[model samples]
Target: MLDRLDKEFAFGREALDVRAYRQELLSSNIANADTPGYKARDVEFSSALAGALKQNGTASNSSTLKMAQPVSLSTSSSLAVTSQGHMSGTSTLAASGGSTDDYGKLAYRVPSQPSLDGNTVDLDAERVQFADNALHFEAGMTVLSSQIKSMLSAITSNS
Candidate 1:
């Protein structure tokens, strides 16, 4: 019975998680619209949801939805910086202040209209996406609520 409940809620739960994360990304893009050289980032929603669901199904403790793990270079054959001007391969990741898990899944958005300052965020598009994702998140929550209500009613009626 517990397993049955888990299976029933898994899809909606995973979807909501993805939608919530996407909302955060869109909000960040909107917030950074004025920052020069700021590239807007987003996930491919359908694919991300699919991957999350797949991982959830295979792993027993897969309650959390996560992106792909970031790749790292082995120290054995890593690049050497002989000159002081050289930057390490991992420096960009560190400078971005984002974990490899997050950076791996996020893709830069191409600007519809190029900005003079090189920021890729389009406010109009970000707003549209944010609204759409919020709607989907609400829908998922409503469906989950309905499911739980129905289960509760069934359990009470039997008692």
Candidate 2:
């Protein structure tokens, strides 16, 4: 059934979503690299993925999930506003892995050197991270495609 397929491929689906979120975050950092007071942000992908699995009780490896860094902030709590007049447009990092709002947990990257503008984005680091993530994302896609193909082949053979 569809549920069986979901159980088999949920991790892949979640991973792809996570990777896309990361790509957006990295792209944002790169876009703001030249802007003043922009802080480079990245997420703990492994941890976020683990948290999600734990939430669903479908995690194959609980020990590895524990190794993932804790998501310190919850989007719901941060979104709570005291009054209608209060300004609350700050894009907060959602605790990745469990919630629907998992836009890669926004942790500020420490700057290699202090900038006069207080911008923390390091172009070189962002570039490397972006490329690495993209490559990994592609790898995940390849594996998922193979799995789907094999499943379809088995179905056709049985029929």
Candidate 3:
């Protein structure tokens, strides 16, 4: 289903989603640059990607283990959400791996020169970052499109 698609195109799909979200966050920051006491917000792409990869790896390993088990194994499964919102699950193989701290997580890149009003939406820096993210997003989308086109060609050629 859609979950399978997400897992299969994990990096490309998730990166696109995160980049889109980051774009929105950055735009909001820029829009509120003149607003007092507004702190700029951005997505921590590295940690998010790492979390997604860990989840996908766990799911793959669990599925493989299930295939090896007997039909009547009757194992119980449970999913636990950590404070940082990462999903952990227990299965027949072993317990969930490890927990992460939200406070000690990656910090956002602060503006080089903060404003008197405490707004940190450096227009120049934000413009550069927006361009870079857009390029990456387009690249990921192009790769995904090529993959789908190839799959379609394969299916049609066999007919």
lDDT of 2 by residue, 1-159 (tens): 655676778788778767877888899999999999988888878986666666655575332222223446544534557998987754565444445344335688989986899999999989999999999999999999999999989989955
On a 0 to 1 TM-score scale, where does candidate 2 land against the true structure?
0.72
Candidate 1 off by > 4 Å: 58-104
State every prediction's TM-score relative to the real structure: 0.70, 0.72, 0.63
Q: Clash number for model 2?
A: 1
Candidate number with the higher lDDT (1 or 2) = 2
Candidate order by lDDT, highest to lowest?
Answer: 2, 1, 3
The clash tally of candidate 3 reads: 0
Per-model RMSD to reference? 8.7, 7.4, 12.4
Against the true structure, candidate 3 reaches a TM-score of 0.63
Q: 1-159 in candidate 1: lDDT tens per residue?
A: 665677677677667777877888999999999999999999988877766666555235445333323444343334678899987653322212113242237789989999999999999999999999999999999999999999899989956
Q: Clashes in each model (backbone N, CA, C under 3 Å)?
A: 0, 1, 0
What order do candidates take by TM-score, descending?
2, 1, 3
Task: Give candidate 3's whole-model lDDT.
Answer: 0.61
Error of 2 at 3 (Å): 0.9
